[model samples]
Target: MTAISDRPQMLPEQFEEFARHLGRTVEGIRLEFINGKLGIKPVPDGDHGRIIQWLNRICIQARPELYVHDQGLKIQGYRGGFARPDGTLADADAFVGRGDWATTEDVLMVAAVTSFDSETDRRDRVEKPRAYAEASIPVYLLIDRDSAEVVVHSQPDGVRYESVRILPFGKAVHLPEPVGISLDTEPLKNWVR
Candidate 1:
């Protein structure tokens, strides 16, 4: 008589090899796995790139704890899920002994400069905010090129944030305690979208 086998037919580890293979071939597009689903983000436009650059410089200057990370951006989530924000601010100490990604534990905020495309706009304003909140990133700073405004979202609870503050170009918006950044908006006003 043939013996019955107890081992599972397909182990979970088998699938990631396929994903890794797919990831290697993609170019210019950003890929993420959020809550077990795939998310694709297009390359930022020229204006978006400038906005990200400005945010990086100003944030690092404002706080010693903040740094500009250009690549390999991710916030760790369950079951190998990761989300890549355009730019990010995390405690400088958090990078110790890690590779490939950054955890949300020490992430003070995530930054995104919205695209002119409608689908991209929704992804930035809606889907990303929820994902960031779920990862427990304390703040989300969104520069809406469409509206010529900056919005700060903080105090995440579940899939939503408790605080949503909007500031038009040339208006001062406090980044709140912990981050505690007081940004001068004059340059942002001068920024041409």
Candidate 2:
């Protein structure tokens, strides 16, 4: 059988049109454009949803003035890419009036809860981090269920994250400036695969 892949399936404009149409017709799939390639992100499992919930609660409690979920961003710096982060931390009105793909400006952080899929490694762990960093997003929180770890990528210098800190599921993850908050990841252990 031919190998299924996440290669450059289509050009950026075509991808955007396809993604928009799919968003209206499809029920649970999400599309991303990163590194000039197309990626399909399936609806997350229950545990994956729970992890996002867990982080959402902590973020709300720590920074009541900001919101941390339900946002998409334009990324890959000048590459014209788009992504719908599992959870996007930004000012309450950061995406107000912006259409489906909003600019990455003022985005404090983006979180990804690994789905149990073949592309989890490359999509969540590899491409996304680079894309978010290139877009100068302050932080990228990876809830890697497969590895049972939390990988924090921060301090982007417009290329890649200069600082990366990985911690087991049960430890606390300290997010740096712009996203000045601490995550009590003890609850993450129960949700990992």
Candidate 3:
């Protein structure tokens, strides 16, 4: 019997087409492909939206040249993986004309805000860190609603991040170079479930 890991992954081009089709047909869900498995992201709740909004405000004030929002990226070092990071930090025009699945070349950071879903642990906590690291993205920010913590991952060496710092809500979190910004996470406490 063929194991799940042994199953063939859908090609990136094919996946993009399917995703576009789904985006047109579906209303509330988002799709992602990471580590050879398809992932479904449910519509975020109010607290989740607020967290992203707060982060965006900080990012815009700190670095107006950069942007952070839902942007699709091709990841995992040629694994046909595609991910729509809740917040993708990069140059303002980094994705201009790049189409749906933009290359990770200009990405400085990718943030994932955990949703109340069964896939959050695997998709945001595990697979995404690996995928973003493999793409050599400078930072991977995780705002974990489940635990009320901010996890900052940085310094990718092609396989994984060399530095990871976790701070509870209400503490300060510093993102490393390429995303040089200090976050006062106290407001984050108010956005958690």
As for TM-score, the candidate ahead, 2 or 3, is: 3
What is the RMSD of candidate 1? 7.1
TM-score against truth, every candidate: 0.78, 0.92, 0.95
Instruction: Give one digit per residue, the lDDT tens place, for model 3 in 95-168.
Output: 99888788899999998889988988988888889889999999999999899999999999998999999999
Q: Clash number for model 3?
A: 0
- Per residue, candidate 2 scores C-alpha lDDT tens digits across 42-114 of 8888888888888878888999878875776777464568888999998888888988988888799999988
Candidate 3 to truth, TM: 0.95
Between prediction 1 and prediction 2, which has the larger TM-score? Answer: 2
Ranking by lDDT: 3, 2, 1
Question: If ranked by TM-score, best first, what sequence of candidates would result?
Answer: 3, 2, 1
Give the local distance difference test score of model 3. 0.88
- Model 1: lDDT equals 0.70
Which candidate, 1 or 3, would have the higher TM-score against the true structure? 3
**Runs of candidate 3 exceeding 4 Å displacement:** 76-78
Return the top candidate by lDDT. 3
Q: Rate the local accuracy (lDDT) of all candidates.
A: 0.70, 0.84, 0.88
Candidate 2 backbone collisions, by pair: none
Question: What's the CA error at residue 180 for candidate 3, in Å?
Answer: 0.6
> Which tens-of-lDDT digit does each residue in 73-109 have in candidate 1?
4544443456667877776656667654556677777
